[model samples]
Target: MTVQLPPLPEIHHPKIQALFQKSDRELVTLFQRHPEEGQYFAAIFCRYGQVLYTLISTATRSPVQSDYLFVKTWEYIYHEMRVLDLRVTTPRLSLQSWLINIAAMMINRAEVPPVEEIQYSLKDTPPVFWCYLNQALNQMAGNLRLVLLLSQTFQWSHTRIAAYLHAEGESISASDVKQLLVRAYQALEDALPEDIRDIYLAQPAVTA
Candidate 1:
């Protein structure tokens, strides 16, 4: 598939190093304010680009399709971030998870050839389950919700989650990740309606 994508800023751009010092939220804020400044977004891409591409590529198993979705995902992020309120997205996810969510949305929207088997999208999900699950996740505290999304949606290790959180300015450890996940699971069960749980159990597992 031939696709059009905006060229990334030069790797040796002088601002890249300086922007790297800023955290994800900081870079997001900067990009929000100055949509014309590509460097801030570039730095964000540098931080998670490989993981994001890997996610899309892993799910697609087609480099051409992966490249198309990769570009589309960033294109979505480029616009979405402009109006994105960090406070109250449905899933209340961390930036990494949020980015992956965008990629998943894009992936699900694409027409997969009959030969391909995809994972980690809401494609086959029941609508009621989707709504209820979002509600359940949203009911949790920010840290717990973020931890659960990272752990369950992306299957990131506690150490990886802790390290990423620490880099984002939180003071946390792997022990904290495990403890929060325990609470998150309980919180999810309490937040979900019982009938929805029964319905979800009978369906194919939904992945983010």
Candidate 2:
């Protein structure tokens, strides 16, 4: 949680620390308005680095791929910051949503490994994919959603998931974990919007 970006502790110097104190909108303005001052952009990066990393890592499920996309996402942000007009964006996303959409876009665009090795690799998708995915997930049952997220995002084994639930006093057996996962997949498919389903159908099937 601490800002440890090298050579520029965003919270170290009084002036730099002040950048951290500003709101996202404020930080964004400084980032755009004063492209020469990296402190503003650095502050935003330091603030959201963990969040972005978590999002990328969960989606990719491969440490190596996650690392690559994490850096690339920021690189994209750095290059596109000037032209990003949050106010005028369709559907009008806040800064955080915009950042997430960028990550989702990048993840979708990333090349898939050979089909044999592609377990959780996602296909190229429209930005609306991320937007609607949140809504679909919200519609799923609590237990189903939790199991699905843990399996897909964390790549947790069924036994690991059972142990996790057991420790939490839920006593979910591994067999139950398997069943829950099946239902979870069905639930997710049923919950997704029609457009998203169409998008998935349009893509070549990924054998996972």
Candidate 3:
């Protein structure tokens, strides 16, 4: 069954609320004439950058690619917003969802380099584990992987993870976040190679 994402929050800050409330035409005009609006634009990036990185990292399974894609996505958005007709009538596709879909498409179409390019050489130690982890992470989607990394690697509290995912000012129930974390961990466990899986399973809890 598909999981339901929580509703997005409204901008509470008066300045931000005012910016968002402005017509698309107004925003485009400001962008073209003001140019220095980049200062205020940071507010949007500050709020969504981590979430976007989390999503792209899970999809690309490469930190380098994730970094690249995240930047590219924003650049694309900046360009598109400047030229967007802003007259669309689709009720279901908000700006966030539209950008997400574009990101997904860009990620899927991205070309993976040859194995040689991916090889990591270090002094005396093999990077095999990282390679395996990347492969396994790519098998899962962004949301699940975010849950896994936050819950397993970072050991963030369920309430915190829920707060990030929900985007709502209110925290989600701890039980709900716990369930999502469990499922993400299970998926990662199943995707891992047998040898690596055993090692990961045998390891003690990761320190916060």
Write down the TM-score of every candidate.
Answer: 0.48, 0.48, 0.38
Candidate 2, residue 53: Cα displacement in angstroms equals: 0.4
| lDDT string, candidate 1, 96-169, tens digits | 88888888888888665443443423224422234446657877889889999999878999999999999999
Q: How close is each model in CA RMSD to the real structure?
A: 18.3, 16.7, 20.3
TM-score of 3: 0.38
Q: What is the lDDT of residue 162 in candidate 3?
A: 84
TM-score preference between candidates 2 and 3, better one: 2
* Residue 64 in candidate 2, Cα distance off native in Å: 2.5
- List pairs with backbone clashes in candidate 1: none
Relative to the true structure, candidate 2 has a C-alpha RMSD (angstroms) of 16.7
Q: Candidate 2 — worst ten consecutive residues by lDDT sum?
A: 1-10
Model 1 per-residue lDDT at 131:
43
Model 3 misplaced stretches (Cα beyond 4 Å): 1-29, 89-92, 112-208
TM-score of model 1 vs. true structure: 0.48
Scored by lDDT, model 1 comes in at 0.68
Give the per-residue lDDT of model 3 (tens digit) for 92-112: 565556667667876777665
